[model samples]
Target: MAKILIILDERTLYLYQNNQVVRSFPVAIGKASTPTPTGNFSIINKLKNPYNKALGTRWMQFTHRMHGIHGNNQPSSIGKAISNGCVRMYNKDAEFLYDRVSIGTPVEIRQNRRTDSKNKSGYSYYTVKTGDTLYQIAKKFNTTVEKIIAINPNIKNKNTIYPGQQIKIPD
Candidate 1:
Protein backbone atom coordinates (compact mmCIF):
# COMPACT_ATOMS: atom_id res chain seq x y z
CA MET A 1 0.00 0.00 0.00
CA ALA A 2 1.04 3.61 -0.56
CA LYS A 3 1.56 6.28 2.08
CA ILE A 4 -0.35 9.54 2.23
CA LEU A 5 0.89 12.66 3.92
CA ILE A 6 -1.52 15.58 4.29
CA ILE A 7 -0.19 18.91 5.38
CA LEU A 8 -2.99 21.04 6.71
CA ASP A 9 -1.14 24.31 6.55
CA GLU A 10 0.11 23.61 3.09
CA ARG A 11 -3.34 22.58 1.92
CA THR A 12 -1.72 19.67 0.09
CA LEU A 13 -1.97 15.90 0.07
CA TYR A 14 1.11 14.02 -1.05
CA LEU A 15 0.89 10.43 -2.17
CA TYR A 16 4.09 8.55 -1.52
CA GLN A 17 5.27 5.21 -2.78
CA ASN A 18 8.63 3.91 -1.59
CA ASN A 19 9.19 7.18 0.27
CA GLN A 20 8.92 9.25 -2.90
CA VAL A 21 6.09 11.59 -3.71
CA VAL A 22 4.12 10.09 -6.56
CA ARG A 23 1.27 12.59 -6.66
CA SER A 24 0.11 15.73 -4.95
CA PHE A 25 -3.18 17.59 -4.96
CA PRO A 26 -4.48 20.76 -3.42
CA VAL A 27 -7.06 20.11 -0.72
CA ALA A 28 -9.46 22.07 1.42
CA ILE A 29 -9.24 21.58 5.13
CA GLY A 30 -11.58 22.17 8.05
CA LYS A 31 -12.60 25.57 9.27
CA ALA A 32 -10.89 27.22 12.17
CA SER A 33 -13.57 26.11 14.63
CA THR A 34 -13.45 22.49 13.48
CA PRO A 35 -9.86 21.96 12.55
CA THR A 36 -8.70 18.73 10.94
CA PRO A 37 -7.24 16.20 13.35
CA THR A 38 -3.56 15.50 13.03
CA GLY A 39 -1.81 12.14 13.39
CA ASN A 40 -0.92 8.95 11.59
CA PHE A 41 -3.96 7.15 10.21
CA SER A 42 -5.06 4.70 7.53
CA ILE A 43 -7.61 4.63 4.76
CA ILE A 44 -10.35 2.54 6.35
CA ASN A 45 -13.05 2.96 3.74
CA LYS A 46 -13.58 3.91 0.11
CA LEU A 47 -16.86 4.84 -1.50
CA LYS A 48 -17.72 5.96 -5.02
CA ASN A 49 -20.51 8.50 -5.44
CA PRO A 50 -21.12 8.76 -1.72
CA TYR A 51 -24.62 10.21 -2.56
CA ASN A 52 -24.06 13.30 -0.45
CA LYS A 53 -24.10 16.59 -2.29
CA ALA A 54 -21.35 17.97 -0.14
CA LEU A 55 -19.28 14.78 -0.42
CA GLY A 56 -19.41 14.80 -4.24
CA THR A 57 -18.15 11.88 -6.34
CA ARG A 58 -15.87 9.94 -4.00
CA TRP A 59 -14.95 9.41 -0.41
CA MET A 60 -11.80 8.02 1.15
CA GLN A 61 -12.38 7.72 4.86
CA PHE A 62 -9.46 7.78 7.21
CA THR A 63 -9.03 6.41 10.72
CA HIS A 64 -10.26 9.72 12.09
CA ARG A 65 -13.91 9.11 12.77
CA MET A 66 -16.25 11.07 10.51
CA HIS A 67 -13.25 12.76 8.90
CA GLY A 68 -12.04 11.69 5.48
CA ILE A 69 -10.68 12.95 2.19
CA HIS A 70 -13.66 13.34 -0.08
CA GLY A 71 -14.78 15.14 -3.21
CA ASN A 72 -16.67 18.40 -2.91
CA ASN A 73 -19.31 20.05 -5.00
CA GLN A 74 -17.61 23.40 -4.60
CA PRO A 75 -14.50 22.81 -6.66
CA SER A 76 -13.27 26.33 -5.97
CA SER A 77 -12.87 25.48 -2.30
CA ILE A 78 -10.18 22.91 -3.03
CA GLY A 79 -7.39 24.95 -1.48
CA LYS A 80 -9.16 26.79 1.31
CA ALA A 81 -9.95 26.12 4.93
CA ILE A 82 -13.73 25.96 4.70
CA SER A 83 -14.85 22.41 5.35
CA ASN A 84 -16.45 21.18 8.53
CA GLY A 85 -13.56 18.95 9.50
CA CYS A 86 -12.74 16.72 6.55
CA VAL A 87 -10.34 17.17 3.69
CA ARG A 88 -12.10 18.28 0.50
CA MET A 89 -10.81 17.56 -2.97
CA TYR A 90 -11.94 17.95 -6.54
CA ASN A 91 -13.94 15.00 -7.85
CA LYS A 92 -11.33 13.91 -10.34
CA ASP A 93 -8.55 14.26 -7.79
CA ALA A 94 -10.54 12.27 -5.27
CA GLU A 95 -11.23 9.55 -7.80
CA PHE A 96 -7.60 9.41 -8.75
CA LEU A 97 -6.55 9.04 -5.15
CA TYR A 98 -9.23 6.46 -4.43
CA ASP A 99 -8.03 4.35 -7.33
CA ARG A 100 -4.38 4.53 -6.32
CA VAL A 101 -4.72 3.99 -2.57
CA SER A 102 -6.07 0.94 -0.79
CA ILE A 103 -8.06 0.54 2.40
CA GLY A 104 -4.95 -0.15 4.44
CA THR A 105 -2.84 2.64 3.01
CA PRO A 106 -1.21 4.69 5.75
CA VAL A 107 -2.32 8.32 6.04
CA GLU A 108 -0.69 11.09 7.97
CA ILE A 109 -2.34 14.46 8.63
CA ARG A 110 -0.12 17.07 10.17
CA GLN A 111 -0.28 20.75 11.18
CA ASN A 112 3.19 22.14 11.35
CA ARG A 113 2.56 24.88 13.90
CA ARG A 114 6.24 25.52 14.30
CA THR A 115 6.48 26.59 10.67
CA ASP A 116 2.96 27.62 9.84
CA SER A 117 4.31 29.35 6.76
CA LYS A 118 1.93 28.42 3.98
CA ASN A 119 0.18 31.28 2.22
CA LYS A 120 -2.29 31.76 -0.58
CA SER A 121 0.53 32.20 -3.12
CA GLY A 122 1.81 28.63 -2.60
CA TYR A 123 4.71 29.59 -0.40
CA SER A 124 6.08 27.16 2.24
CA TYR A 125 7.57 27.50 5.68
CA TYR A 126 10.64 26.06 7.37
CA THR A 127 11.92 26.01 10.88
CA VAL A 128 15.48 26.81 11.83
CA LYS A 129 17.44 23.96 13.35
CA THR A 130 20.55 23.74 15.43
CA GLY A 131 23.73 24.40 13.45
CA ASP A 132 21.68 25.73 10.51
CA THR A 133 22.87 28.92 8.87
CA LEU A 134 21.12 31.29 6.50
CA TYR A 135 23.46 30.31 3.67
CA GLN A 136 22.78 26.61 4.18
CA ILE A 137 19.05 27.13 4.53
CA ALA A 138 18.94 29.31 1.41
CA LYS A 139 20.72 26.60 -0.58
CA LYS A 140 18.48 23.90 0.80
CA PHE A 141 15.35 25.85 -0.16
CA ASN A 142 16.82 26.97 -3.49
CA THR A 143 16.48 30.58 -2.42
CA THR A 144 18.81 33.29 -1.28
CA VAL A 145 19.31 34.69 2.23
CA GLU A 146 18.50 38.20 0.99
CA LYS A 147 15.18 37.08 -0.36
CA ILE A 148 14.36 35.27 2.82
CA ILE A 149 15.26 38.31 4.90
CA ALA A 150 13.34 40.63 2.61
CA ILE A 151 10.18 38.63 3.11
CA ASN A 152 10.73 38.23 6.84
CA PRO A 153 11.30 41.70 8.16
CA ASN A 154 10.94 40.49 11.73
CA ILE A 155 14.26 38.81 11.41
CA LYS A 156 16.58 41.37 12.95
CA ASN A 157 19.75 39.34 12.83
CA LYS A 158 20.27 37.33 9.68
CA ASN A 159 23.27 35.64 11.19
CA THR A 160 21.60 34.45 14.39
CA ILE A 161 18.59 32.20 14.07
CA TYR A 162 17.38 30.24 17.05
CA PRO A 163 16.26 26.67 16.82
CA GLY A 164 12.51 26.33 16.22
CA GLN A 165 12.26 29.80 14.69
CA GLN A 166 9.80 29.75 11.85
CA ILE A 167 10.77 31.43 8.57
CA LYS A 168 9.06 31.92 5.27
CA ILE A 169 10.23 30.24 2.08
CA PRO A 170 9.00 32.12 -0.94
CA ASP A 171 7.71 30.31 -3.97
Candidate 2:
Protein backbone atom coordinates (compact mmCIF):
# COMPACT_ATOMS: atom_id res chain seq x y z
CA MET A 1 0.00 0.00 0.00
CA ALA A 2 1.12 3.61 -0.61
CA LYS A 3 1.19 6.03 2.31
CA ILE A 4 1.51 9.80 1.92
CA LEU A 5 2.60 12.31 4.56
CA ILE A 6 2.30 16.09 4.21
CA ILE A 7 4.31 17.82 6.94
CA LEU A 8 3.05 21.38 7.26
CA ASP A 9 5.62 22.43 9.82
CA GLU A 10 8.65 21.60 7.71
CA ARG A 11 6.84 22.29 4.45
CA THR A 12 7.70 18.85 3.15
CA LEU A 13 5.94 15.66 2.06
CA TYR A 14 6.81 11.97 2.24
CA LEU A 15 5.68 8.71 0.66
CA TYR A 16 6.32 5.39 2.36
CA GLN A 17 5.72 1.67 2.23
CA ASN A 18 6.72 -1.15 4.60
CA ASN A 19 8.62 1.45 6.62
CA GLN A 20 10.89 2.21 3.67
CA VAL A 21 11.35 5.72 2.41
CA VAL A 22 10.53 6.33 -1.24
CA ARG A 23 10.80 9.87 -2.60
CA SER A 24 11.00 13.48 -1.36
CA PHE A 25 11.33 17.04 -2.68
CA PRO A 26 11.25 20.65 -1.51
CA VAL A 27 7.81 22.26 -1.50
CA ALA A 28 6.59 25.85 -1.28
CA ILE A 29 4.00 26.26 1.44
CA GLY A 30 1.30 28.86 1.87
CA LYS A 31 2.23 32.36 2.98
CA ALA A 32 1.81 33.52 6.56
CA SER A 33 -1.04 35.67 5.28
CA THR A 34 -2.79 32.60 3.89
CA PRO A 35 -2.18 29.23 5.49
CA THR A 36 -2.48 25.95 3.61
CA PRO A 37 -5.79 24.32 4.37
CA THR A 38 -5.20 21.47 6.77
CA GLY A 39 -6.93 18.10 6.59
CA ASN A 40 -6.71 14.93 4.54
CA PHE A 41 -6.67 15.41 0.76
CA SER A 42 -6.73 12.87 -1.97
CA ILE A 43 -4.79 12.99 -5.22
CA ILE A 44 -7.63 14.61 -7.09
CA ASN A 45 -5.75 14.87 -10.35
CA LYS A 46 -2.31 14.73 -11.90
CA LEU A 47 -0.41 17.18 -14.06
CA LYS A 48 3.08 16.99 -15.49
CA ASN A 49 4.80 20.18 -14.42
CA PRO A 50 1.66 22.23 -14.55
CA TYR A 51 1.76 25.84 -15.65
CA ASN A 52 0.86 28.63 -13.28
CA LYS A 53 0.54 31.11 -16.11
CA ALA A 54 -2.18 28.99 -17.62
CA LEU A 55 -3.95 29.45 -14.33
CA GLY A 56 -3.36 33.24 -14.70
CA THR A 57 -1.01 33.28 -11.71
CA ARG A 58 2.10 35.35 -12.26
CA TRP A 59 5.49 34.09 -11.25
CA MET A 60 7.23 35.62 -8.25
CA GLN A 61 10.50 36.38 -10.08
CA PHE A 62 10.53 34.44 -13.28
CA THR A 63 8.80 35.13 -16.52
CA HIS A 64 7.19 31.71 -16.27
CA ARG A 65 7.04 28.69 -13.96
CA MET A 66 8.49 25.73 -15.74
CA HIS A 67 10.59 22.66 -14.95
CA GLY A 68 10.03 20.31 -12.00
CA ILE A 69 9.13 21.62 -8.57
CA HIS A 70 7.00 24.47 -9.92
CA GLY A 71 9.71 26.02 -12.04
CA ASN A 72 8.95 27.86 -15.25
CA ASN A 73 10.98 28.85 -18.24
CA GLN A 74 11.30 32.22 -16.52
CA PRO A 75 13.72 32.65 -13.61
CA SER A 76 12.22 33.79 -10.29
CA SER A 77 12.75 33.75 -6.51
CA ILE A 78 11.81 30.17 -5.66
CA GLY A 79 13.18 29.52 -2.18
CA LYS A 80 10.83 31.67 -0.18
CA ALA A 81 7.19 32.26 0.71
CA ILE A 82 5.58 32.88 -2.68
CA SER A 83 2.86 30.44 -3.51
CA ASN A 84 -0.69 31.53 -2.62
CA GLY A 85 -1.51 28.22 -0.89
CA CYS A 86 -0.72 25.30 -3.13
CA VAL A 87 2.35 23.19 -2.36
CA ARG A 88 4.88 23.69 -5.16
CA MET A 89 7.56 21.16 -5.87
CA TYR A 90 10.24 20.89 -8.48
CA ASN A 91 8.73 20.01 -11.83
CA LYS A 92 10.39 16.61 -11.68
CA ASP A 93 9.26 15.76 -8.16
CA ALA A 94 5.73 16.85 -8.84
CA GLU A 95 5.66 14.86 -12.02
CA PHE A 96 6.99 11.80 -10.25
CA LEU A 97 4.43 11.95 -7.48
CA TYR A 98 1.69 12.72 -9.98
CA ASP A 99 2.41 9.50 -11.80
CA ARG A 100 3.01 7.15 -8.87
CA VAL A 101 0.21 8.04 -6.48
CA SER A 102 -3.26 7.24 -7.68
CA ILE A 103 -6.34 9.44 -7.64
CA GLY A 104 -7.47 8.02 -4.29
CA THR A 105 -4.21 8.11 -2.31
CA PRO A 106 -4.77 9.83 1.01
CA VAL A 107 -2.72 13.01 1.46
CA GLU A 108 -2.65 14.00 5.13
CA ILE A 109 -1.74 17.65 5.59
CA ARG A 110 -1.33 18.56 9.25
CA GLN A 111 0.57 20.86 11.58
CA ASN A 112 3.78 19.34 12.90
CA ARG A 113 4.54 19.81 16.62
CA ARG A 114 7.35 17.33 17.19
CA THR A 115 10.19 19.65 17.96
CA ASP A 116 12.54 17.31 19.81
CA SER A 117 13.49 14.43 17.65
CA LYS A 118 17.13 13.59 18.29
CA ASN A 119 17.53 13.41 14.58
CA LYS A 120 16.87 16.94 13.42
CA SER A 121 17.64 16.08 9.85
CA GLY A 122 15.06 17.41 7.42
CA TYR A 123 13.39 14.37 6.02
CA SER A 124 11.26 14.09 2.86
CA TYR A 125 9.73 11.25 0.87
CA TYR A 126 9.95 10.43 -2.85
CA THR A 127 7.73 8.05 -4.80
CA VAL A 128 9.49 5.87 -7.31
CA LYS A 129 8.52 5.49 -10.98
CA THR A 130 9.96 3.98 -14.11
CA GLY A 131 13.70 4.81 -14.58
CA ASP A 132 14.24 6.24 -11.10
CA THR A 133 17.29 5.75 -8.86
CA LEU A 134 18.76 7.04 -5.60
CA TYR A 135 21.28 9.07 -7.55
CA GLN A 136 18.71 10.66 -9.83
CA ILE A 137 16.24 11.48 -7.06
CA ALA A 138 18.97 12.88 -4.82
CA LYS A 139 20.41 15.05 -7.56
CA LYS A 140 16.97 16.28 -8.49
CA PHE A 141 16.28 17.26 -4.89
CA ASN A 142 19.73 18.88 -4.50
CA THR A 143 20.62 16.14 -2.02
CA THR A 144 23.05 13.23 -2.02
CA VAL A 145 22.61 9.49 -2.33
CA GLU A 146 24.31 8.78 1.01
CA LYS A 147 21.97 11.24 2.67
CA ILE A 148 19.02 9.46 1.10
CA ILE A 149 20.22 6.13 2.51
CA ALA A 150 20.90 7.70 5.90
CA ILE A 151 17.28 8.74 6.22
CA ASN A 152 16.03 5.40 4.92
CA PRO A 153 17.81 2.51 6.65
CA ASN A 154 15.91 0.08 4.49
CA ILE A 155 17.55 0.86 1.17
CA LYS A 156 20.80 -1.11 1.14
CA ASN A 157 21.77 -0.17 -2.41
CA LYS A 158 21.58 2.92 -4.60
CA ASN A 159 19.94 1.33 -7.63
CA THR A 160 16.57 0.34 -6.20
CA ILE A 161 13.56 2.32 -7.29
CA TYR A 162 10.65 0.12 -8.29
CA PRO A 163 7.36 1.85 -9.05
CA GLY A 164 5.54 2.71 -5.80
CA GLN A 165 8.74 2.47 -3.71
CA GLN A 166 9.20 5.23 -1.13
CA ILE A 167 12.66 6.61 -0.41
CA LYS A 168 13.56 8.95 2.42
CA ILE A 169 15.55 12.09 1.69
CA PRO A 170 17.83 13.53 4.36
CA ASP A 171 18.96 17.10 4.54
Candidate 3:
Protein backbone atom coordinates (compact mmCIF):
# COMPACT_ATOMS: atom_id res chain seq x y z
CA MET A 1 0.00 0.00 0.00
CA ALA A 2 1.10 3.57 -0.74
CA LYS A 3 1.38 6.17 1.98
CA ILE A 4 1.46 9.94 1.74
CA LEU A 5 3.33 12.25 4.05
CA ILE A 6 2.81 15.99 4.01
CA ILE A 7 5.44 17.97 5.86
CA LEU A 8 3.84 21.34 6.48
CA ASP A 9 6.98 23.11 7.58
CA GLU A 10 8.91 21.98 4.53
CA ARG A 11 5.95 22.44 2.21
CA THR A 12 6.74 19.14 0.55
CA LEU A 13 4.66 16.03 0.04
CA TYR A 14 6.38 12.69 -0.08
CA LEU A 15 4.97 9.49 -1.52
CA TYR A 16 6.15 6.35 0.14
CA GLN A 17 5.94 2.74 -1.02
CA ASN A 18 7.12 -0.08 1.19
CA ASN A 19 8.93 2.39 3.44
CA GLN A 20 10.78 4.01 0.56
CA VAL A 21 10.26 7.49 -0.79
CA VAL A 22 9.01 7.13 -4.34
CA ARG A 23 8.39 10.77 -5.14
CA SER A 24 8.40 14.23 -3.64
CA PHE A 25 6.58 17.39 -4.71
CA PRO A 26 6.55 20.95 -3.52
CA VAL A 27 3.28 22.21 -2.10
CA ALA A 28 1.57 25.36 -0.91
CA ILE A 29 0.09 25.12 2.55
CA GLY A 30 -2.16 27.24 4.70
CA LYS A 31 -1.13 30.66 5.88
CA ALA A 32 -0.33 31.45 9.48
CA SER A 33 -3.79 32.75 10.32
CA THR A 34 -5.45 29.66 8.89
CA PRO A 35 -3.04 26.81 9.42
CA THR A 36 -3.55 23.44 7.78
CA PRO A 37 -4.62 20.80 10.23
CA THR A 38 -1.86 18.44 11.29
CA GLY A 39 -3.19 14.93 11.76
CA ASN A 40 -3.39 11.48 10.29
CA PHE A 41 -6.16 10.93 7.76
CA SER A 42 -7.05 8.94 4.67
CA ILE A 43 -8.13 9.99 1.25
CA ILE A 44 -11.87 9.66 1.20
CA ASN A 45 -12.63 10.62 -2.40
CA LYS A 46 -11.03 11.65 -5.67
CA LEU A 47 -12.31 14.21 -8.14
CA LYS A 48 -11.06 14.86 -11.62
CA ASN A 49 -11.22 18.44 -12.79
CA PRO A 50 -13.78 19.46 -10.27
CA TYR A 51 -16.04 22.40 -11.14
CA ASN A 52 -13.78 24.76 -9.24
CA LYS A 53 -11.13 26.01 -11.60
CA ALA A 54 -9.23 27.41 -8.68
CA LEU A 55 -8.61 23.83 -7.59
CA GLY A 56 -6.68 23.08 -10.76
CA THR A 57 -7.22 19.72 -12.49
CA ARG A 58 -7.61 17.30 -9.59
CA TRP A 59 -8.89 17.13 -6.07
CA MET A 60 -8.17 14.44 -3.50
CA GLN A 61 -10.55 14.82 -0.66
CA PHE A 62 -9.31 13.93 2.80
CA THR A 63 -11.37 12.77 5.73
CA HIS A 64 -12.37 16.38 6.26
CA ARG A 65 -14.94 17.54 3.75
CA MET A 66 -13.75 21.14 3.74
CA HIS A 67 -10.03 20.51 3.39
CA GLY A 68 -8.21 18.30 0.89
CA ILE A 69 -5.14 18.11 -1.27
CA HIS A 70 -5.89 19.72 -4.62
CA GLY A 71 -4.26 21.39 -7.58
CA ASN A 72 -4.22 25.14 -7.96
CA ASN A 73 -4.49 27.43 -10.97
CA GLN A 74 -1.73 29.64 -9.62
CA PRO A 75 1.52 27.92 -10.30
CA SER A 76 3.53 30.64 -8.61
CA SER A 77 1.88 29.80 -5.33
CA ILE A 78 3.11 26.23 -5.32
CA GLY A 79 5.82 26.93 -2.72
CA LYS A 80 4.03 29.48 -0.65
CA ALA A 81 1.78 29.36 2.35
CA ILE A 82 -1.40 31.03 1.10
CA SER A 83 -4.05 28.40 1.05
CA ASN A 84 -7.19 28.17 3.16
CA GLY A 85 -5.96 25.15 5.13
CA CYS A 86 -5.98 22.67 2.20
CA VAL A 87 -2.64 21.57 0.82
CA ARG A 88 -2.21 22.88 -2.74
CA MET A 89 0.03 21.55 -5.48
CA TYR A 90 0.79 22.37 -9.07
CA ASN A 91 -1.76 20.97 -11.51
CA LYS A 92 0.69 18.50 -13.01
CA ASP A 93 2.02 17.39 -9.66
CA ALA A 94 -1.50 17.05 -8.32
CA GLU A 95 -2.54 14.96 -11.28
CA PHE A 96 0.52 12.79 -10.93
CA LEU A 97 -0.14 12.13 -7.27
CA TYR A 98 -3.87 11.67 -7.81
CA ASP A 99 -3.29 9.07 -10.47
CA ARG A 100 -0.92 7.10 -8.29
CA VAL A 101 -2.80 7.07 -5.01
CA SER A 102 -6.28 5.74 -4.43
CA ILE A 103 -9.06 6.34 -2.01
CA GLY A 104 -8.18 5.18 1.52
CA THR A 105 -4.47 5.84 1.04
CA PRO A 106 -3.10 6.84 4.39
CA VAL A 107 -2.22 10.54 4.56
CA GLU A 108 -0.16 11.97 7.36
CA ILE A 109 0.22 15.72 7.77
CA ARG A 110 2.69 16.88 10.36
CA GLN A 111 4.82 19.87 11.31
CA ASN A 112 8.60 19.43 11.19
CA ARG A 113 10.05 22.14 13.34
CA ARG A 114 13.61 20.92 12.82
CA THR A 115 13.61 22.11 9.21
CA ASP A 116 14.01 25.63 10.52
CA SER A 117 16.80 27.70 8.95
CA LYS A 118 19.06 27.14 11.89
CA ASN A 119 21.30 24.09 11.98
CA LYS A 120 24.26 22.93 13.99
CA SER A 121 26.56 23.68 11.04
CA GLY A 122 25.38 27.29 11.01
CA TYR A 123 23.56 27.89 7.73
CA SER A 124 23.27 31.03 5.68
CA TYR A 125 20.21 32.31 3.83
CA TYR A 126 20.35 33.64 0.30
CA THR A 127 17.77 35.73 -1.49
CA VAL A 128 17.04 34.40 -4.94
CA LYS A 129 17.87 36.73 -7.80
CA THR A 130 16.66 36.73 -11.39
CA GLY A 131 17.95 33.87 -13.52
CA ASP A 132 18.96 31.91 -10.43
CA THR A 133 18.76 28.13 -10.41
CA LEU A 134 19.52 25.63 -7.70
CA TYR A 135 22.58 24.62 -9.67
CA GLN A 136 23.99 28.15 -9.60
CA ILE A 137 23.32 28.54 -5.91
CA ALA A 138 24.87 25.20 -5.09
CA LYS A 139 27.92 26.03 -7.19
CA LYS A 140 28.29 29.38 -5.50
CA PHE A 141 28.02 27.78 -2.07
CA ASN A 142 30.34 24.86 -2.85
CA THR A 143 27.50 22.41 -2.23
CA THR A 144 25.36 20.08 -4.29
CA VAL A 145 21.99 20.85 -5.84
CA GLU A 146 20.42 18.08 -3.81
CA LYS A 147 21.72 19.68 -0.64
CA ILE A 148 20.08 22.97 -1.50
CA ILE A 149 16.80 21.30 -2.31
CA ALA A 150 16.99 19.28 0.86
CA ILE A 151 17.17 22.44 2.90
CA ASN A 152 14.55 24.39 1.01
CA PRO A 153 11.63 22.08 0.41
CA ASN A 154 9.49 25.07 -0.49
CA ILE A 155 11.30 25.35 -3.78
CA LYS A 156 9.08 23.37 -6.12
CA ASN A 157 11.01 23.88 -9.34
CA LYS A 158 14.74 23.93 -8.74
CA ASN A 159 15.19 25.27 -12.23
CA THR A 160 12.59 27.98 -11.88
CA ILE A 161 13.23 30.54 -9.21
CA TYR A 162 12.02 34.13 -8.77
CA PRO A 163 13.70 37.22 -7.44
CA GLY A 164 13.23 38.01 -3.75
CA GLN A 165 12.62 34.41 -2.73
CA GLN A 166 14.82 33.28 0.13
CA ILE A 167 16.53 29.90 0.34
CA LYS A 168 18.88 28.29 2.73
CA ILE A 169 22.53 27.47 2.05
CA PRO A 170 24.45 24.85 3.98
CA ASP A 171 27.94 25.65 5.04
* Structural similarity to truth (TM-score) of each candidate: 0.65, 0.49, 0.65
| Candidate 2 Cα misplacement greater than 4 A, ranges | 49-79, 113-171
Q: In model 2, what is the error at residue 126, expressed in angstroms?
A: 26
Please give the lDDT score for candidate 1. Answer: 0.81
lDDT of 3 by residue, 11-97 (tens): 999999887999999999987656676556899989999999999999998855478999998999988889988999989999999
Order of models, best lDDT first: 1, 3, 2
- Stretches of candidate 3 above 4 Å error? 113-171
Better of 1 and 2 by lDDT: 1
Once fitted onto the true fold, the runs of candidate 1 whose alpha carbons sit more than 4 angstroms away are 113-171
TM-score of 3: 0.65
lDDT of 1 by residue, 1-171 (tens): 589998887899998988899999999998766667655679898999987989989998985468899998999998898988899998989999988999989987766644433478655677565567788778756788898888887887677677667777777
**Candidate 1 — which pairs collide?**
none
